[model samples]
Target: MSPSKPTSRQFEMQLEIAAPRGAVWSAISSDTELRRWFAPDAKVVPRVGGEILWRWGDLHAWPQVIEIWEPGSRLRTRYDSSIVDGEGGKLPLFLDFFLEGEGGRTTLRLVHSGFGPEATFDEEYDGISRGWPVELRSLRLYLERHAGLDRRLAWCTTTIDLAPAEAWERLTGEEGLAAGSALDALTEGDPFRFTTPAGDVFEGLALCCESRAFSGVATSHGDGFLRIAVEKCGGEHQVWLWLAAYGPAGPGLDELEARWSTMLERLFSASGSMSAGV
Candidate 1:
């Protein structure tokens, strides 16, 4: 008897942006533009058989092999086998980008396909499902609002053994990010305001609120974007806080990073003895 064919799963999303086609193309296919919002560092060789690198600091560098490159229209890539999840991964996981734009506004579609239906693929599958929304929204924010400016970013991430919901509660606790009950009364697209434990106030339209995630504009930070997500990886809940500020006052991101990092550690880590940050 012949062996069974592996089943596959995928994710798809679309966006409408107030930017030109060339700009959107560069944002996805160019290494320089990708570094602004997608990841801390990136490298792209924009052709079939070439490679793209998605780097997270000095630790993780995810690589993909380009399979199709159509300049401003479409690009497709397959996963590089070296980074497969443990031992049971089926190769050829693909990411496809399709763009159609005219005049000053453009529509972009993303399809991430070729995932296996096995437990080994669970961690990465979940990670990508949670991560891409944050990255893509950062892209839209860059093109529509902060285009052509160097982005200043402050990011903090920590992992706790707790479930995502529990970790999220601690993240929004009175002693932490401290979002008020006013947010609970707000709905998507509704104007909202809240203050953090650090005495920072933010006012913006609500964009997202989930048991494990929260996102909205940070109008006070030079009209910047703020996102917090709790991701589950290999049974551990990882909380990530990312802030992107544009214009002259980018919030001294390094200072903010140090501050938030200490906050997360004290709130989530085994020891509450870490030093206080900015």
Candidate 2:
């Protein structure tokens, strides 16, 4: 074997998107274009050997360098950062995007590799595997639906005083998402829709669904992407909710944030009273 590949270290995925190769290329390589669907803030120089910077507010910044560039055909970038290793050491991660187009359709293939050995395998692989599909769908929505429009982004985090497992239960419970109720009947590429108690409908293609997280394209609103994830830190479980609107109007960011905050508070409040047998 060629230096025996680490288990799940390299992930390759391809999807056909309803857009031209140029559109797909711009969505991935252009800094301002990426902000609409990829990162909250992006700065990139398109040529090979150029520096690319992506940021999610003050929470994280992944600085990458363009390794290869062929415009609408192929592009490769490398990220060397201590953030992924989590030990103040740099780890190299590569992201390759290849595109082939026929008429108005483009096949986009992504190769993400360079994850460290088994010592850091699960933590890195698990997170990226669950995230890529949703991100790809977001890309599709951006290129196919909102090619030249601006987007409104909303992000929020809610911390529950319960363990990860317990908080996960409530999130997927009947009163919460109850994803299992609909998940069993849904399959990949199939239409997935869920109506919240407050009458908001979340519709999309059924993407990734696991015990701790769920993500999909929000078809109810064109060019929208939604991810709801719960991760445990210390004694508390934090629920992260991220949604982006590529459309020009409606569902303002302030209103979206308030809605999510109220929903989280209600879930924890109800769970608390039930624990006290109220």
Candidate 3:
């Protein structure tokens, strides 16, 4: 006889919103409204077997393959995180949210299942416990203040250094390679625009710059800071840049950091090579 399969465990959370079922459903169902609270960047195809893409910054926040979509009732999906890790595979788990109407009030029940035998139910449960409160709070505030959708906000920064002479070359080098190339391709004079792998773009602008130093702030997605400076620390032609981003604080911070770090690394390498020849 084959071994009996282990029973799957599930966790759930419930919330009561002082809103009509239709209002609550619209908040979760519409992609634009969903981005206001759940993610700063997201695209949703609300249908069975459709896909939902969520991004927090310059990274893949999380992608969910829709399993069920019942307008004004329930939404079910399978979470997939494989875009970040090559070895990542789909886990035996799924999530569902059921929205029900109750005489001028809306009740939302979130359920997670398929936690296998070795699952850390408590750990997973605890993490989401805190997360939901903050997210939901934002949702409530958004609905009350904006009638349902919150304004999008985001910020980004870039800082680096090079020898004064080399810096000048790149800042004013070949006709098409001056200030245009000094900054990231996504950057334009004054305002800088960055597009994530998932196709979500953020807009900002240069706020400051000087000899061997540059800084900027962008407004639209949120508040972002960027700085670039050059100094001979330990005499090795060091260039340092710092970018601190702030937005809705979604599920893509780690991935955004990784992608930005790689981009900066490449920028530094190329700048260094040019500096060497100066």
**Clash counts for all predictions:** 0, 0, 18
State, as a TM-score between 0 and 1, how close model 1 is to the true structure: 0.86
lDDT of 3 by residue, 172-229 (tens): 2332113344443332246665444434444566644444555455353344444444
Ranking by TM-score: 1, 2, 3
Model 2: per-residue Cα lDDT over 1-278, one tens digit each = 57866444688899999998888999998988988888788998879899889876654587999999998999899987333556767767899999998789999999999776565455566567766877887788778778888777667666566777777766766677655446544556677777766666778876666667766677776637777778543234567777777655435666666666676667876443211100
Number of the top-ranking candidate, with lDDT as the measure: 1
Q: Would you list the C-alpha lDDT of every candidate in the order shown?
A: 0.76, 0.73, 0.54
Q: Order the candidates by lDDT, highest first.
A: 1, 2, 3
Q: Write the per-residue lDDT of candidate 1 for residues 1-278, one digit (tens) a residue.
A: 99987797788888898999999999999888887767778899878899999886643588988989998899998884324655778466789999998999989999988777877666677677766766677798889988878777887777667766777777877877887445545555777666777666767766666556777777767778787777664455567787778887585778777878877887888822222211
Reference-based TM-score of each model:
0.86, 0.80, 0.48
Count steric clashes of candidate 1. Answer: 0
Model 3: how far is 166 from its true place, Å?
A: 40
Task: Compute the lDDT for candidate 3.
Answer: 0.54
